[model samples]
Target: MIACPRTLFWIVLLVAACFLAGTTSGAASVPAPADGPGLTVVMDNNYPPFSFRDANGELVGISVDLWRLWEQQTGENVQITGLEWDDAIRRMEAGEFDVIDTVFYSEERGEIYDFTAPYTDVDAVIFFDADLPGISGLDSLDGFVVGANRGDSTVKELQEKGITVRKYPSYEAVVSAAKAGEIVVFILDKPGGVYYLHREGIQDRFHYSAPVIRGQLHRAVKKGDAALVTKIDEGFASIPKAAYDDLDRKWYGTPVAEPADLRLITFFAIVAVLIILLLVVLNHTLKQSVAMKTEELKQELDHRRRADEALNRATQKLGFLNAITFNDLQNAVFSLSGFLELEKSLPADEKTLAYRQKQAEILHQITAMLRFAKNYEDLGMKPPVWQNVSQTFLIAISHLDMAGLRRTITLDNLEIYADPLLERVFLTLAKNVLLHGKTATEISLSCKRTQEGLVLVFEDNGAGIPLAMKEKIFERRFEGKKGLGLFLAREILSITGITLTESGTEGQGARFVMLVPEGAYRFTDNS
Candidate 1:
């Protein structure tokens, strides 16, 4: 009996060793010659429309279609692996995958990966709470805590400006934080944010700011994958616009019809048929009716063209005016900076110098507001560049002369992509604190990222905005005869696709919060 058991164990060990050898041989054999250059592409299976898993657990979307075309054209044997976005990115960075599909190229990304020519364009926007004031541009987010996705381009941009940025790992975390009042603002790519908001049934709870930051979506390849990138570029160039349009219609449910050919042959065919009928009286009547109809159509078209031109001119004029005003404000601030420097050199009369320095600081705040306004005007222009939130904040704070404010501003490493107009929103709120919260000695500003978007918080221990004024604050020309700073702040923020609102009450001081919608930030060649 002992001998029989020992023999059985040896037999089982022999089978296991054979199986291991076969597995090793399979892995070492390499892909067949006909399989072409074996390459593995990584992508996020959770991102819909671009790349995602279907109901049957199949990886599919526009990126998949494009990848198939690439394989066909280049004879590259490609395998796809679906993973989480962060995991895919990390793996690609680690050189574990040959490529990552559907990423937006930015300055920060340029350091990490080689990007192909863009295949799609998108925007980053700001989304605010339902009770928030309407935001028309970037200027409306002043003093609001903004939330953004961690490791996103928008976080860098927000940090560039003086605005506070909070970072979160995922979109869901951002939404939860916003709902919990942990952050006031969120920013994200437009479609992704909208999809998430709708999916979470929070569409009615938040609003997006306008004048979106445009970003171009592209495929990312491992650095030094020049051959692959060139092949992709060539393939993209070869694909007909019609084919792309058709694919778009298929996925997005939008019909795209080709224009009918209007060749001479077609016109002559109709003419010949009419003449062959030989109905002279009918032809004359028809010609008269057609002429009248054409004339009317031409008249309407001319009127519409004129109207469009007039509207464009008016918009241009308004933009120019805003720019000029912004410049004036900047000049005033610059002058104040110089005066403050001069005051340092003058004989020190402690109290008088202090008062003068305070005055200069106040002027500095006004300049910040002006800079924000200028940014708003610039963002309104066609082909606006991505505004760096971090840079803007640095500029705003650099002018503040911290020695004078008696308040500390704490900011986390958060970035956001928004139009420069958002700076004005921050400036406006800060200016309000200086003007109205005179008794308040301490003000706090913070920013962090949330999964849903970016959230910003601004709080001051001063006389807060009255309840009566809260509703009216965002209205244009409100705030009792003052320049439409708050109103324009709201309007400017709206233009960037974000919303701003007041939270907390008078006795509790004031808290301003802003949310950036998903898809609000994007990468674009036009910058």
Candidate 2:
């Protein structure tokens, strides 16, 4: 069981204060473009594979190696101070460190600090006694006691998801409780969790569950260190891909799994297809039945034909009058605007010219609205049909200028049952990139299989939608940009059963994910 809320507050403050006084207060100033005191970087002392004391008592890990590389790259010296996790946070607030390494991202922390993009991906896993079976995820923890490090995000996330968490002083304590059956399960970041299990020689006593949350590791820099932040970001971007892969090999001490190859992806994709309920509607007997019905209707229609001819004459006269009225009004407006411009060229009063200009602007707006209405009338009027994804994508891209933009598509084998307006969906998406994706260098379309179905991803390497606005961007009458494009695109896709969601990070890029459920998609194979 956890301590009461009030008791936990005092315990945390007391612990932070006790470590604060003993932790060395470094006097280094945050680095600048030139001539600075470098940086004081702090991290938890025992987070192995990130920062920890080796058997030789040498401080080494991914974070240490990165800082060393930064020093070599920029001629900037950095001081690494190791303290308890709680103490590191406290000292950072006291300005003892310019950067905090090995920090996880969260909204609350984001308020006080700026972070570099994730330097490493981290996974949170559930660990249980080895004898326990069927402990795969959070769902398996119900009706069982669980332990968490008192101040960990894993604890907060669990509690927020409505699980009861027994708080321990540290992660090591949580593992001990789980192994002793004091708690049925323990949750922690996988790398550190794996390390402690081995260090305690209890690796054989417990087993790990599938990852609970796949998160990232970021460096937390002071809020105002824009220059230093820029350098940090540049340094990370400069690091070779092989550097991280090699480090993974050294740290995990195993052959790490790479991203699935195309062949394997295709194999698993075939397996994951749950059902193939084609939406095509046809009845073999309907043609013959309709022919017989038409013969019978023909006899009856002879009598009705004369009455229909009379109604047609009346309808044609009314349509002619409507067309005449619309044309006359448009011609009159144009003539009036021409006369007003001619009057303005003469020595006319400024007020009179301004009034004429206002009238012209109103007429222009009316014309624009009329055009919009004309185009809007045909929407959703056509029957939905099977649209070839690659062909439609090619048509949409062909309409764009394609001057400086690059488009990549991998949807060759896919087709979806959607409204013929499906072409407009891709068109609108491309137009959005042109209008708003100022930084985008490329636009891409691709498909991948998920447990639910296939996802059609439209992505651009431009400024991404903020998390706050992910859903808001799709609202029909959102904060007032032309939201109609995406709104109509969503409606068109919905004529079948595809749903779209935006899942990109705020700064990474825009990713529009359209989930096409089981019955909506099929593959075209060339035999």
Candidate 3:
């Protein structure tokens, strides 16, 4: 159905050339003709191998041969004329020709042309690009733009089924319209469509489905031309059944085999197989390499295991030795303090009293230093655990005897993973504020979450630390009321990677802000 003009033109030339071989029956067997009526019969040229032209511009096909036989049997000069399907129909409607030898039967056209008794059957089918999946039949044509030859049986058939079709003037026009995106599929008689595709050298470009509409193909004459219709029926009846069989065998005996390029398929198949073999070899090599590396890694881990045990044993011994030695030194200091106390009570002048006082002061400072060392030694000795911040703050404050200090605790369900000495960190902060904030009152504890971490603010409204001394406040043995509380608090927090900084209004209150890193903190849903 998609045959180009040149294709049919060439076919017409070939058929005409067949006539030039001296006579139409020059090569083939046929009964000699006895001329009768010289009537002209017009038909659609688009119906290839049925009623189409050849390379010599001569008519040749199923109906053409039948008409030739009809002329031989009936002794009539049955001249055949070929026109585009649509033009043929228009001319026939205008009575430009006396009769149409090959036309499909439909009720709408019955009003315009009288038809003979039905002959052989023809199928209506769907054709589309071969790359697409085959659609089973008409029921599957929803949403498709179907092309149909104008005035062809396929157009009215598709329309009756409520399917949309773009009518083209000719087969070539339909193909062009489809290629131009006007339609997605085309509808036509299956064999003629396939033969057209073959002639055009585009058989592999398309595929067609089984019959969608099966109808009895009939030849029609002018409306009320009962005489012409009767004559066609007589011609068909006169033809022998064996002659019809012979014609069928001659036209459609051989099946058209699909011309495929097998060499390309074989080349790609070999490449695929080689790539698979290479992957197999590489996989085996990689497995062997991994096994060797794994053995080496096992040996390295064995050496590290022995080294770690030795280091742990040595650390344990050092800790035990330090504990024993510090205990003995503390006893000796206690004994010296007692002896100095007894001697100071016995007797002395002003200079002697001052000398005794100096000795007592030095002993007290030494005791403080020894106690700090003992507490510091255990700071990071224990693994960190999740401790409730509110409970820890309460415990730290309880030990401080904050009866004279008014402070509010706003800690909710917050908890953090930190050393057991975390309690001491808070205790140290409370003790520092009591000793340092001279006019301080109303200390408050609250928290806020930030991009970098969590912040716990311990602040008080007081004549806070001076600007120059803010950073210096946390320095070891700097001029606080006495011991290194702030410095030791920072050291305790650092064991678990928490950081502490002072960021209050210096004149209003001294604020200690502790930033707990991201992974180290989470909130309880109940809070």
* TM-score for all models, in order of appearance: 0.41, 0.40, 0.42
lDDT of 3 by residue, 1-527 (tens): 11112322333333333233235333543543555557778888767556766656666666777777777677777767889887888888887887786677777888888988876666778887553453678877665567888878778767877887778777656655544434447887765666555545666667788888787667788888899889878986788777777655444442232224345666789999999999998979877888889989985675455345434543564475478557856765776676677666777777667657766765665666567666667765555667778767755664443534566666667887676788898888887777777788667889999998999888887767777777777775623334467777877676556888888876798889999987666666653
TM-score of 2: 0.40
Ten consecutive residues with minimal summed lDDT in candidate 1?
1-10
Candidate 3: deviation at residue 253, Å?
3.3
lDDT of candidate model 3 versus the reference: 0.69
For each candidate in turn, give its C-alpha RMSD to the true structure in angstroms: 19.9, 22.1, 33.9
> What's the true lDDT of residue 66 in model 1?
63
Stretches of candidate 1 above 4 Å error? Answer: 1-37, 53-58, 134-139, 176-182, 240-243, 255-527
- Candidate 2, position 424, lDDT: 85
| Error at 182, model 1, angstroms | 4.5
Cα lDDT for residue 328, candidate 2: 52
lDDT of each: 0.62, 0.67, 0.69
**Highest-scoring model, lDDT:** 3
